[model samples]
Structure formats: C-alpha cells, structure tokens
Target: MVTALIVLYFISAITNSKKIVILSGVVFSFLLYPETFFIICAISLLVKILSTYVIIKDLYIALTVLVLILLKNTFFSTASGYQLVGVSFALFQVCYYIKDNISCGDLISKLSFFPQLYCGPIVKPSSFDRLKKINIKSLALYHLIFAIGLFFKIYVAYVTHKIFLEDNSLLNSVFWLAYMYSDYLSWSLMGIGIAGLAGFKMPMSFRAPFFCRNVSQFYSRWNITVFKWCNDFFKVSGSKKYRKYKAYINIIVSVSVLSLWHGLTFNFLSFGIFNITYFLIQNKIKKYRKILLISQILFYFLVGYTFNGIIPNYIFPTISYKYGILFIVSLVTLFLFDFFFYRKVKKIISISPPLVIAVSLIFVTISFFVRHIDGQFYYAQF
Candidate 1:
C-alpha cells in the first residue's frame, strides 16, 4: 500500500495531473477495502445531499443527527465489524469535503491519504487546502520523524504488553493508563510523521497534554485536531439568557461529541461524562486545582479499567513492595518526560539526527525482545 501510494505521489508530482491523481488514489483505496469504501460513500452521499439542499445552519444540525445515527450503530458495534472499522475517520473527512464543496482533486487527496487513512487527526477540508503543494525536498527529515514516531509506538506496545502480563493491581492499572496515553500519543505522532514524509501537512494531533493542569486544558492539548474540528463543527452558541452557562454547556457538548467520535460504546460515553462532571466540580472549587489534577489522573486509571473490563481485585493489591515502588517511579518518570521534554524531544532529534537514529534503532531492538501480539490501536478500529 505504501509503495503504491509513493508511486502515485511521484507520478502526480512529476506530471501534475491533479484530477487523475485524486481519482486514481480514491479508486485504489476503494479497491483496497471495498466494504469500508461503500460505507464511506453512503455517508458521504447523505452529507452531500443535505448540505446542498438545506440551509447552512440547518444542515449542521441535520448532519450532526445523521452522523450520530451512523456512529451509534457502527461505533457501538450494532453494525458488523467490517462495516465499523475505519468508518469514523472516513465519515468525518467525507462530511467535511461535502460541506466545504472542495475541489475534486483536493477531496480525493484528503480522503485517500494513506498516512491517516485508517485513523486520523481528523483534518478538515479547509485545513488540507493549503497542503495541496507537494515536493520531495528534505526527505531525510521526513524519515527521521517517521522513525521517531514509530519507535515510540513500538516501545509503548512493548511496555503495554508487559504491563498486562504482570499481576493486576492499582500499580498495574497506573502503568496501563500510562501505556494507553502513550499509545495514543504515538499513534498521532506516527500519523503526522508519515503524512509529513508524503509532503502533506498533517495537523498537530497532540501537544503537552501531560503537562495540562486541568481537564479543559487536557482536552484542548490532547488530540488537538479533533478538538479543532469539534470547535468548528459543534460550536454551541446558546441564547442571551443562557450566555453565562455557555462555557460549561459547550464543554460538555463538545467533549461528548468528541468522545463519541472516539467510539460510541458506554466506556467512551462514561469517559466523557466523567470529565464533564469533573470540569463542573473544578469550576465550583477553583482553589482545589492540585487536588483536582491528582483526582484526574486517578479518574483516567479507572477509565482504563472500565474501558478494558479488567477490574483489579483491590484498589491497592497486596503486591511486592519493590514492584509497587517501581510502578510509581515508572509512572512519574513517564509523566515527567512528556511534561518537560515534549517540545524539546523533537528539537533534540532535529539537531542531532544521528543520535535520534541510534536511539530509535535501540528502541526497536528492545521492542523485539519485549514484543507481544498487540492488537491495532484502540482508536484505529474506529
């Protein structure tokens, strides 16, 4: 698939055949997964019809309902596995394309872009408009970005597998949540990295989420492109009488929408609700920010357990003292890395390419030793 896309990219670059490139690319994606393609086409057609026939404001509301139905069925597993996997992102892209009335060439390129085909940072059509230009300049930098992201993903997979193998306990749960966050971070980075290599300016999907001191900040930093899309598409502007509560209402509505975008299962639904409740509580007691932050971390740990359906026997299992200490140290270290070095890590790699390569190779080697048959990313299925 990668090879085919590379050939297509170069062909387009050399000949500048925009329509043919986009059409052929779309055809290739359809051929690769006909089932998913058909589903995407259905939703795309629905969105297109509504957008063309209805008023802009009404279309937004109707489109939201249409998408909600599709999500509830597919994401909640009411649809078959073949119908569900890979539909979430494709649905979002197609809707964006139809609403924006994007050019044929750009629409095709945005949807069929292989780097984010399976999962995405959920780029809006407007966002991809500026990325229409393609070039092969500075290819080495792209490779480095891809390598670093892939290394992080593989390493997280390795550690996650190891965590599951250990005894189930609060310590393991903490590590598990850490792994889950890292897994998501890695996935976003990988998408950005690969898209960059292809000369497509993928949107920023993550920032210093770990460093965020509040729930609102956390959501804004995490899965950044998704939030950006939500802000645009799901902007909840209440009437004058309800203006003071607009922020809270927007927070809940937006997060609920984004959470459903994650998946329509109860687990994801609860995750959104939990955050909403916490956000409200924090607003009422602004002085307890530190306590709220600590609580937020624990809430995430509970989410991991709830999402995975693997409850520990006790809140604090009677595990070895050494292992318990190890878990705390590991969790703190992971958080610290992201908090302090989130921005610097990328800069370090750009400045010291050889060192980055060496470290990536080492991480890959370690991954081989610790590897287990990990499943696709939690979000990738969507």
Candidate 2:
C-alpha cells in the first residue's frame, strides 16, 4: 500500500495531475490489501464521484470520509483491524487533503498528520505549511526534543500502567489518572517537538493547558489547533448574533467529530457526549458565574472511570443501548451542574528544580518498572 502511494504520488507530482492516475493509485493500493485499502478507496471514490456530481465542498468530503471510516471500524473490524482502519483512514485523509488544495480542509488535513494523528493537538494546515519551510538546524533540534517527549510517553506512562493498570486495586485508579496525565503531557511535548522539527510555529495549544482555571479554558489551551480548525472549517465560530448558542453548537460538533474520529465505537461516542456536556455546562457557568471547583475534580474522575469501564465492554458489543443511556445521563449531569454553580480558582505553584527532579525520577522509575505491561502507544498505532 505504501509503495503504491509513493508511486502514485511521484506520478501525480511529475505529470499534469490527472485524476485517473490518482484514482488508479488508490485502486492499486486497495487491491494490495483488500480488507484495509478497499474501505479507504471506496470512501475516496465516493468523495470523488460525489464531488463530480454534486457541488459539495471539500470540507463536507473530509467530514464524510471521517464519518464513513468511523462507521466501518465500529461495525466491521476486530480490535486490531479497527485500529488499522482508523489509522489508515486518518493517514489517507491527510494525504488527500494535502494534494487536493481544498481550502481550509486541505491545510488542516496536512496539519492533522503528525501530532494530530497521534494523541492530537490538531493543527491548521496554513500554520503547519509555514513551519515546514524552516531551516534544517531548527528541524534537527525539534527532533531531539520530540525524542525526549517520546521517552516519557513510552517510559513513564508504561510504568504507571504496569503498577496500577494491571493490579486493579483502588490505587490503580489513582495511578491510571496519573498515567493519563502523563500520557497527555508526553504526547503534547512530542507534538511540540514535531511542530518544531517541521518548523511550524507553536500555536497557543500547550501553554498551561494543564493549569487552566476552567474546563473551557483547559480545552482551548490543550488542543488549540483542533479548536481553531473546527472553528474555521466546521463553521462553529462565535458571533454576537448568536455567540452563546454558537459556542454550544461548536462544542457539540467538535466533540462529536472527535468522538467519531476515534472510530465509531460506543465508547468513543460516550466520550464525545461526555465532553460536550462538560463543555456546555462550562459555557453556561460563564453567564451564571456559578463554578463548582470540587465538581471539576469529580467530573473528571467520573467521566474517566466510566469511560475506562465502558471501553472494555464496548469492544465486545460495539453498539449498546445501555451504554447510550449512561452516556446521555453523564452528559446531562455535566450540563446541569455547569449551569448551576461557580468553581474556585486553584493557585498555581512555581516549579522548583528539586520538585521537577523528583517528579521526573518518579516517572522514570515507574516507567522502567512497568514498561512490559504497556500496550502500544495510542498515537504510535496511527
């Protein structure tokens, strides 16, 4: 499949960019691995056929591809197959978007490749392309930084998983949460490294996302690139005419797309609904000024635990009415609380050298101890 794509890319690059060659390349790849490539080709073909018949925009095509991929994975594939399809679709989407020049979708599709494909600090294409033009020295330095980030993701998260994930004790939950945090941080750092290596300017996604005072702020900082993309391409931007309502719509669409992108599993949908509800409530609180600081902690714990539980169960039964109900309930509760309360601001502490060393040592020690038990890094699969 990779070889076919490379050949096709070379042909397309040198030739007059005929659609036939492009389509043929895709077909060749599909034929090489029917189980995986077929679906990818079918979706791309659908987009191409649809684009010819209907004047549907590129963004819609991109969305369609994502939706179809999710559905295919959710309904058809085994666990490994599902990941393979999901990652393949993601990669294909990026490549197609880059070649087609389909407005913001094109740029975003390219930007979504590295960091976004993995743990996702999804970026916009324009910004990404700009970075790609940077000098070689900067790129090398960025790769080094990314390597360090990869070490933590592989080591620290692995250790935490071994210590807690396999044991299934109460402490396991705490360790799991800690592991998740580390996972997010490690991935984000890796993203920064990639962006730097690619020479793309760092968008405002990672500057203090962890220390955000509120859920909304946290999301804004955590994956500013995705947030920006959704706003630009998904047409969910804020406006005075319907700023509040628009914010809610953006939250829903963005979260839903995120869920679907994870592959069309019930757990992914649940996670999406969970986050949407959380964000909706967070937005409502902005108007009411009613923040529940403690609830923030509770919300994260509840959602995380529920998601963890649902994922294993979801693998066996991709669709479950009970899971759906639970998902809706979780979402509803998040909005209800968000509408009714205010949360206290937590103080940020300065990172002393000793504290940093301690944290690093703990992470390294834990990672080394439990490296064997860790599954493939989620992004690495992509």
Candidate 3:
C-alpha cells in the first residue's frame, strides 16, 4: 500500500510538472519510511520528460529540488540516508541535462550500466547526441571494445582492492588514497573506453594526468570532461582584468563541486579543501615552470601519503577510512615517477594494441575484485 502511494505521488508530481511537490513528497517519504529513493528516481525520470521543452527555466527548479532533498537528508536522516540523498541529487542533475533536448540515441550511446549509475565522468548532452548517429558497422566494433571495457570494470578494479587497500592507519591511509587514484583511473578508462566502443566519443578522465607539471595542467589531464563542463557552464575562463585571480577561482569552484558530487561526506570536503589549497599554491608560482612542476610533484606526494589508506577511520572512527594513506601515496609516487621517468608512456601505449589489451585486462581484474568485496557498484552511489 505504501509503495503504491509513493508511485502515485511521483506520477502526480511529474504530471503537474511541479518539482517542488515531487521533492517534498520524496522528502516526506524518505524521512518517514526511507524506502522511497528508488521511487523518487522513477518519478525524476517523468520530471525529466516534462521539462524537456522548458529546460533552461526548469534547470534551476530541478537544482532547487536537489538542494531541498540534500538539506532534508542532512538535517533529519542517517549517514546512509545522506548518501542516498546525494545519489538522488546526482541523478536529478543528469535528468535535467537530458531534459535539455538531449537525443535518445545520445543517451543510449552514453549508457554504461555501472558508471552511469554511480560517480560519473558526466557526459555533455551535445557530445552524447552526436555519437548516437554512428553506423552499424562502427557500432559492432564498439561492442567488442565495450566487452573489454566491462572486463576491466569488473575484474581489475575488484581484484586490486586487497593489494592496494588496508584497514585505517597512517600508512594504510596513504596507500588507500593512492589506490583510489589508480582505481578511479582504471574504472574511468574502462567506462569511457566502453562508451567509445559503443561508437560514442567520450572525453577521458585521465590523459597522462599524473605526469602533469602543474595544477592547471593537472586539471586539463585529469577529468578532462568535468573541467570542460565547468569551463563551459560555469564560465570559468579568466577575465582580462582578473586574469591572475581566475585560475584560483576556477580551481576552487571546480574542486568544490567535484567533491560535493562525490557525496556530502566530511572526507570528501577535506579532499576538496586540500586540492584547492594545492591548486592555489601551484597557480601562484606557475610562471616559474620548473618550480611549479616540482611543487606539483611534492603536492601529489603529500596528498598520496596523507590521504591514502584507512587513516580516516582511525582518525574519526565513526567514519570508514579504509585504505587511506596507501592510496594517496601510490598516486603521488606514480605521478612523480611518470612525470620524471615515464614521459613516453602515452606515446608508447597509443601505438601498442597488445599493451593496451594487457593494461585493460589488469584494470578489469581490479574492478571485479573490488566490486566483489565492496558489494556495491562504485559509480552507482553517485
């Protein structure tokens, strides 16, 4: 009986094109019952359709709904509930983007069952639409690519969890941070590669990001799509009069938004704060290119060592800080090594099909193992 009412409420919300009403219903249901997130997501789809023709106007409304949901969860719900609220808001953002006249074909082309659900490398509607019109032969080739991608997503990310992660500790925390970098790198590569194989041209998350000599370059190489999106939508370009300050502003806003999107956890906020400080410092000394490079390397190292393995859990026992230090250290070390020694990494891989396959396999193995242990889709919680 409760399920039916929830369904009917969503239907009513969408039919009326009233996001506030829909969000209100969702909040009430979640607060009282906590089993309505799924139903809320279903209703969100309907809202997606209803707003298609009036996207510019509705986007703000949708954002408002998300804010309300987050507020309600933060103030009244459990930690799990807060996470769920974050996920719901993330989904709503996607829905709003889709409602902005994104083609069905583009939507299909961008679909990656796992990544699309959780933390995403958020695709632009324009790019998604363009990819949808590819011919069948290309799509067939893409399917083969997608299969390989799926393997990495499942196997590589999953299997490597134990190798890179450990319980909360200073050393373990650093390791986990480093592990997360690699894990995210592998998962993102697989997700984007699969999308590409499906005949969609997607922006990459890491394009030799670790080798970048400075924060600005780091942003360009890491999560390219997210950076581009912020550039476009947030108008993060430096103004002629405020050119010096622009980079700092852009970095702060972009990192903050990215952190929030990860989930409204304290750890996520800390991560963003740390990144923003790093970027700000890096940007100030950018003119001294060599110094900038060295600083970035040191920054990565510190972040890796400090944030990696599972220190957060120990530091704040109420929170899960698995693999905190180790993860951070690994990423920093990898970045430093790649920048200083493996400059030709991209060039070599770009030309080697066999090498690509092997790397893809490794990533798949890690993803599969991680998923098995975590018992949750990494991106699904987005």
TM-score, predicted candidate 1 vs. hidden true structure: 0.74
Q: How would you encode candidate 2's per-residue C-alpha lDDT over 1-382 as one tens digit per residue?
A: 1123223323432342323443443355345435444343344455445445556565765676566656655655456554442343343344244335354423323422334343455443444444434443344434433444555556555555454444443333344555665565566665455455334543434444434555666656555665565565677445687775875777677676656655666666677877877876766565544364554655655555544552232212232455434434433432332333113111111224334334433544454455444344443333
- What C-alpha lDDT, on a 0 to 100 scale, does residue 330 get in candidate 2? 36
Where is model 1 poorest over a 10-residue stretch in terms of lDDT? 133-142
- Model 1's alpha-carbon lDDT is 0.59
The segments of candidate 1 whose C-alpha lies over 4 angstroms from its true place after superposition are 1-32, 45-83, 103-106, 129-141, 165-167, 238-241, 262-266, 315-337, 340-342, 345-375
Question: In terms of lDDT, which candidate is strongest?
Answer: 1
Candidate with more favorable, higher lDDT: 2 or 3: 3
TM-score of each: 0.74, 0.57, 0.60
Who wins the TM-score comparison?
1
